[model samples]
Target: MASTRAWILKSRPTGMPDMGNFELREREQEALGEGRVRVENRWLSVDPYMRGRMNDVKSYVPPFEVGKPLEGGAVGKVIESRSPHFKEGDTVFHMYGWRDQAVGPAEKFNKVPPLGVSDEQWLGNLGLTGATAYFGLLRVAAAKEGDTVFVSAAAGAVGSAVVQIAKAKGMTVIGSAGGEEKCAWVREIGADAAIDYKAGPVVKGLMEAAPKGIDVYFDNVGGEHLDAAFATARNNARFAICGMIDAYNGAPQSFRYMARVIAARIQLKGFIYTDYLPEMGDFYRDMGGWVASGQVKSRETIHEGLEATPQAFLDLFTGGNTGKMLVRL
Candidate 1:
């Protein structure tokens, strides 16, 4: 019998998580029961949203158990199957990350579509991140052509996608990243302007980037970025509230310009990517065309081996990744 190494939550984090809170253990594979599939994970995703799950609190998703293996998104190839839905060597996407191998019911796995992109691209641009950008910008914010859009964490997985997608739709986009190199990459990926928030106050950078005020805001990093968006929003601007990575680690956030929401008649809506599952076909069709045309680029920061998974996840808070952060096993 084969055994797999997995990372589990050894203790619930109080604020920011550390290596001490996690433990790696080996577990023998169980017998492959009927209607079950075994997979060898190739790429595991490390997202900011996963930070919320580390805390022992209630939210949209359940908190990670103290002693169970941590779970997120992963792309793997089937090594064995007892289910008619899958076969050996089939590539699949499932929510069984933090481990090198996964065995679960067939219903828990979805075969990755052959979209002429690399297998890892499924985790970066064609998976949760891309879907979040697609729904948040188009459906929630209702961003249209000619709109001046502001995106925070513009060099990240979802934010980069939002920048490119907005540009593809003829919207003028301004993006905020932590450093000069990240901001430059944001511009190279189709943002009309890039703000290096580390250089100065975010509100000052945003004001200079879009002097006339922005029509739409796709917020990934909240706190100051959200306040800046409120400060410079044009009349009737729409804001799509995505991940608030700034406050994910128990950081306090103050919004002095929140009064602008009523004064400017701004619309703010929080959304989850799964909420638009019925519109996935449309997301694939549009995002596929943009990617094939060299309009939407997929960028990633990958760590080698499963041992680096915990560090890769921690790097998200420190702005260590320029794009999607993944662990390759």
Candidate 2:
């Protein structure tokens, strides 16, 4: 019999999450019931969206309950299967969370191809992060070739993908990152220009970078950046409201909410991938083909153990990673 190591949320976070909010506990593993498969979590994804889930607030997803192993997207190998379709040792993607193991029905997860460019890619460019970039940019924003694109947090996991994807689509892309190193990497990955958001007035830097206004804004960091996007957006420009990394770690600001869209005549839309899974098929197929053809470049930052899950999850809010942040056990 195997024991399960789990991280349970002890307290809700006020700003950035700390170790005090989570506690580790060990419990005996239960037998798999009919149609269930037991998973050994190999890689867990830490995302900015998680901060919202940590609080007892209402949003697109339900808040994580106190005293429970907080759940998020994870990919793992099936160690035991009661289901006929999934066999032992098959890898699957599921919302399993900050834990060492999980037992759930096969339908609760999606199986990934065993081998690839990298396992981390399955959680990044080819997984939820990739899907979000694909749909959010092309579908929601309706970005086209020749469109000038601006992406906030442009050196992170999803941003890395956006630069390449939009470039492949023939758009002129500019990215806003936090430092010179990140800015350089953004250019290395194909962004025409990369603005250092921490350098100064992002609006001024963006104005100097783009000059002609941006057609689409893929906003990962919101608040002041959103205000800036509204100020310089081209007429009829679209804004894809993804996770707001900026709002995750600080005092919440509610200004410029109405003006961002109304004054700019912007089309702003927020989405959850579960609502867009049917649309995900085309993205997966296209993104896979792109990966196969070497048209897209992806990066993933992996923390190496279950004990490291707390810091890994906390890093997303702090922008402590480049590319998709995941923990590899």
Candidate 3:
């Protein structure tokens, strides 16, 4: 038998999650079972969606149990295998994160392709984050060439992907990030304009960036950003509602311009990546090619060790990461 350390959800969060909501403890693992593989987790993803899962509410995904190990995306190397599907030293991606090791049936993990992208990227672009942007912008929002697109939280993983994908489609991009540094990086990634949301009102920024009005809005941060998008949207503009990071913490916000949605005849749709699973092959082929050709780039803010998971997750609220936030375990 061997021991593994995993983070357990000790309590549901109130307004914002703190270290008090989680517990890191060691647990014993039995020898490999039939059809099983033991993985040494190398990287863990800390995403905004995981916050929704922490609450005991019914939603798209089930909530995290109070006494169980928290889970998300993870990439690992197999240390031992009792199944033919996986072999020792094989790299794989799975949904058993928040831990240093994961042991289960071999089918629980999918083998990572021998692509040039790093293992951590399996949790970011070229993975769910990129796929979310791909389907959200191209499918849900129906972004088109020459269209003006707006992305909020534009320096984060999904938002950054949207900015690049919009450019690849020949669309004009206006990205909104928190500060000057992130806004600069957004522009470097091919955005026609980057708005520092903290510098001024988001609606005012969007107005200046797209004085004629934007054709598509990718909603990542919901509160004022959503209102601004609605207010500044061109007629029949499409809105792809991705994760609303602003409201994920249960913050209360008042909106006065929802009438703009009706006035503009906007098409507002919310989607999950799983809804587009059938189109995943197209996404990987297209996005992977973009990365290879330098048409799109992926950035990550990596934290060290399993113990840093809590802080890394908390950092999402503080705009601590410029792109994807991951923990190297």
- Best lDDT among the predictions, by candidate number: 1
Which window of ten consecutive residues has the lowest lDDT sum in model 3?
248-257
TM-score winner among the candidates? 1
**Which candidate would rank higher by lDDT, 1 or 3?**
1
47-157: candidate 3 lDDT, tens digit per residue = 999999999999999999999999999999999999999999999999999999999888889999777877887888888899999999999998999999999999999
Candidate 3 lDDT score relative to the true structure? 0.93
lDDT of 2 by residue, 1-329 (tens): 86889889899988788999999989899888999999998888888888888899898879999998888888888899999889988888888878989888889978886446666678888888888898889888999999999999999988888889999999999899988988898999999999988889888888898888999999888877787788789889999988787677675755564575676688889876666888777887789889988888877788999899989888776668888888988
Whole-model lDDT, candidate 1? 0.94
What is the Cα-based lDDT of residue 232 in candidate 1? 100
Ranking by TM-score, best first?
1, 3, 2
**Candidates 1 and 2 compared by lDDT, better number:** 1
Clashes of each: 0, 2, 0
For candidate 3, the TM-score is 0.98
Error of 3 at 261 (Å): 1.6
In terms of TM-score, how similar is model 2 to the real structure? 0.95
lDDT of each: 0.94, 0.85, 0.93
